[model samples]
Target chain A: MSILVDKDTKLVVAGLTGREGSFHGLNNRRYGTDLVAGVTPSKGGQDVEGVPVFDTVHAAVQEAGANTAMVFVPPPAAADAILEAADAGVELVICITEGIPAHDMLRVYTHLRRDERTRLVGPNCPGILSPGKANVGIIPAHFFSEGNVGLVSRSGTLTYQIGNELAQRGFGNSTIVGIGGDPVVGSSFIDVIAQFESDPETELIVMCGEIGGDEEERTADYIAESVSKPVVAYIAGFTAPPGKTMGHAGAIVSGSKGTAAAKAEALEAKGVRVGRNPTEVADAASEALA
Target chain B: MDLLEYQGKQLFARHGVPIPEGRPAATIEEAVIAADEVGYPVVIKAQVLIGGRGKAGGIKLANDREEAERHAKAIIGMDIHGFTVHQLYVEKASDIAEEYYAAVVFDRGAKQPMVMLSRMGGMEVEEIAEKDPTAIARLHVDPLVGFQAFHGRRLAFESGIAEDVIRPVGTMLERLYEAFVGEDAMLLEVNPLLVTGDREVVALDAKVTLDGNALYRHPETAELRNTGAEDPQERMARERGLTYVKLDGNVGILGNGAGLVMSTLDVVAQAGGRPANFLDAGGGSKAEEISNAVEVILANPKVTGVLFNIFGGITRCDEVANGLITAFGSLDISVPFVVRLDGTNDEEGRRLLADADLPNVHVEKTMLEAASRAVELAGEAPPEDADRPGPSAGADPDADPEQ
Candidate 1:
């Protein structure tokens, strides 16, 4: 069984009238995701890619019984969309939009934690895909193949690269979750790992992290204490110069606190095979299963 | 984007944080005039982003006009942490009776703004946080309610801040938080918040990092972007909305994702090649973007080869191939290119590249092989690559693209 979304999931597309929202909404639907509703305020009677649109998330929830909300609103309005979805009884919110102000996220997160109704995946992430079952955000649906291994990463392209490597090497995935590359993402590696650990189909886990905050280190600690599944890890940015942000807002080595070396050392301490590169990571995950 | 001390203070001053009166001067004459206006015993501080200005002799007390001119002359060309100073913050120096550390920085762990205060000030905050972790008081603020005076008071009380200075420090923190939130800053700091001999709290230094994402809302702050101190390649990349960092190597690395780009750098280094730069084409990049990236990378003469390690997810490889073909028609891309395309519809992309059959392009199946090929094409001398010291990533001494 997949951890996040599966065959029965009904999705709502937030900001469905926008460029990427409508584009990815169509792509996800083409991949067989149950995108039943769309939300674009003041366009309640419209349809995008044949999905029925509503003025508000609550109206979509009422009319289409949409449980999952995929947000593609701009940065300034993304937090409001997430809050609206959470308030309107959305079970899951996957925000594919990037560049949401950190301050906006701060308030949204505080609100999100207080409410137990919804789970938000990202403000700047590729979102999650449960192999052949569902494609919630922007991850290309066809590249991933259904299998026993579960993968999670803090990066978008790196996840796709490693996912492709795994698929090419005859190792398919049960679910690959992009927890996002923002400092204040909706889901953490620990949150996804907990879900993966309980899934019977997930026999092995691959965690791809990069130099940034202490999330990897914290995840490593959690793994050492609780996880029993065969886990392989790869921390990117070993060759990256310190203090210079390597593209991602979260992928920065601040004051030597978050370095790739420190992350590798932490993970290796937890009995996780740490790969220096993606190719090596694929080999390590393959060997872990063996 | 991290602001210079003077720029940071400007935002603070706008938010009503009491700071030393200062003006940024780019020339010796301006520095002398600023020093004269501020009166003698002024501080001529290099307006660079990095810290340790005092230790690097970038900060000097100018007792008179001639001294200020001399100090400005020495500092304007001085190199600190590889950043050559081009401007100086001429400010009326304060007579410090006591120094206290205060700042509101983004704490990633908390995922919120954190207030940090310490009686032990004038030292590097990073160093203090490492060496004497408990000496500093920390408070996490909820952005929903913003920073409360109670939070600041709690920090002051916990850190054993002097009783008389509590109100001033607390008020200063409230205003600092205002500046941070009002300006959409990721990191706003006032290290060594000095209490002058006249018994008044004043920010002696400021380090503000405005949220690059939110800069669109604050066009005025966005206008303060100091492209003058940036690498020409990096500046161009920033303007084009592409993330780029120039390194001291010959292999110009381009990739779709940041993590993958960083991984490409590592793999290239493993293959005995140093990455000349880090450039992410970003997700869903079309033909035009690919062409732009190629042109930008090729513009760096130090780059002997280009490596395009693309795992097409949202960014299709076929689009990149189309971009490369379009670029070759106009751009003088003399360097050999190693292209490794994989992921969604990769074979179609590969076929397109093979059909184009550009002489300088070599398509590889694996990242390792592609990196190896790029390494070989980047002038086969790893030892010399290590020996030749190049300009720092952010600071380019001679960064004129025309030059």
Candidate 2:
């Protein structure tokens, strides 16, 4: 079975009245996502695409039975939105908004850690999709189809590329999770890998990561210790020069620890198939599957 | 956005940080006037948005007005790290009994604003921290509580500042933190926060980086943006709603995808030519977007050739090919262009380009071949060295007079 989301997973669009929220919500519904509720303060009782609207996530969850929450709030209010959703007992929260001031996320991250029941995906992510089951964020739905391989990534566009490559190779995906490109995201690579490892339908997993953070190192350690599943990884920022920040806010390797070379070496040492090129990711996965 | 030391100090001075009186001068006359106002023993520093200016001969200590004027004249026209200086900051130099460093920056690990303090000042705190991290004191400030007196006092004590001076240092740190957070600053640094012989601390230098995205909140900060220091092509790209950065290379790249642009650069390098710049025209781009991208690529003097690697799914291949034609027609692009269009309407894309009848343009069947061709065109030697050095004979000064 796919992890985090499936066909029956009921979802609510928080801040759905906003531009990105409304656009993505409509796209999600068009892609057959079970978007049952919409949440927007003062715009309650209104409907977007026939979905019932509620003032707060709590009321929406109670009335519409929505367990998953997708947020498109702006940076300043993003942390509060996530915390409100968590307080309302949303089982899963995916934040698509980027550029939340760093200090704001730290408080939210600490709160999420203390609350063990809630699982959050991103504060600067594209969200996840279990192909043929549900699409949560902005990833093009047609590029993904139901299959045995699971994919997880910290990049939005790279996730799309890997999904497209897999679809072209005739291998569909069980789930594609965008853990987001923020340095302090809701979940880490190791956390998603743990979920993929336990999924029975996920025969092989592809992990897409960028430079910066010790998340890859942690994932390598976890893979070495307990993981037996065939894993293929493609790490970005290899050709990138040292001390330059990339497009992603989280993707900067200033200190000695977060270099692309170091991450690639760590993944390779753990027997995970490491692909250097984005186009070669599918080939590496194909070999891993073989 | 990187701010010059004088600009950063302006913000610091507004936030109540005790800074030496100074003014940025565009000419030696202004420098002399500023030096006269600040009194003798002034320091003349080149106003450039680069680090290590002192080592690059951009900073000089002047004992008098004439010395300050001479130093300003020398520094104003100097180039440091590719940035030419047009202005000099003349400030009252301070006597240093002790030097301490302080900075406020976002810590990714802690996911919060952090203040770093060190007794070892005037030097790069990074090196000092690497050698002995214990010598530096780090405090994570809660956004709600901010940098209170206790936080600053703790840092001051940890950094080994005297107990009596802790209150003043604490006040300074608190104000600096307020400025850092209030200004939406990415980095706020005070290098060589000099402690005078009388035990008074003053900021001798300031460096600040403002978040570009948050500039809308601070109009004053947005006004401080120096467009002259930026590449003309980059400014054009920004005006056209494109993200472009000029690099030292020859092969020009135009792609919709950031990942694709990066891969194109790597492929170009692998194909034996460096990339002139990274320009993302962005997805679902139209004819105008393509023309803008072409303009940016052709603007780079180093770019000898151009490559368009379009993978069309939502972005139709024929549309991109038509855009290329439109761009070529509008701009006088003399550089050779190599294109590889794949996906939707591929044959139609090829047919459209063929119909354009453009010279110096070649369509490739694969990305690899297109990259290779672009590299080859870029590797061609220049027609002539227009700015080459003049020929000089080895004649003795005694014999060469009047001859």
Q: Output the number of the DockQ-best candidate.
A: 1
- Tens digit per residue, CA lDDT, model 1, B1-403: 8899988888888899999888889999999999999898999999987777799899999899889988999999888887889888999989989898998888777777888888888987756666666678887788788889799889999988788889998999999999888888888778899988877999999988888888889999888888878988888888788889887778999999888998999899889888889999999899999999987887777889999999988888889888888988888667899999987668988998899888889999999999999999877533454433332222211111122
Name the runs in model 1 displaced over 4 angstroms.
B129-133, B381-403
Worst 10 residues of 2 chain A by lDDT: A238-247
Clashes of 1: 0
Give all candidate RMSDs, comma-separated: 5.1, 8.5
Candidate 1: which docking quality band?
medium
Q: TM-score for chain A of every candidate model?
A: 0.98, 0.97
lDDT of 2 at B40: 88
Clashing pairs in 2: none
Give TM-scores for every candidate, taking all chains together and pairing residue i with residue i.
Answer: 0.95, 0.88
Which candidate leads in lDDT? Answer: 1
Which TM-score value belongs to model 2? Answer: 0.88
Error of 1 at B277 (Å): 1.1
User: Model 1 residue B23 lDDT?
Assistant: 85
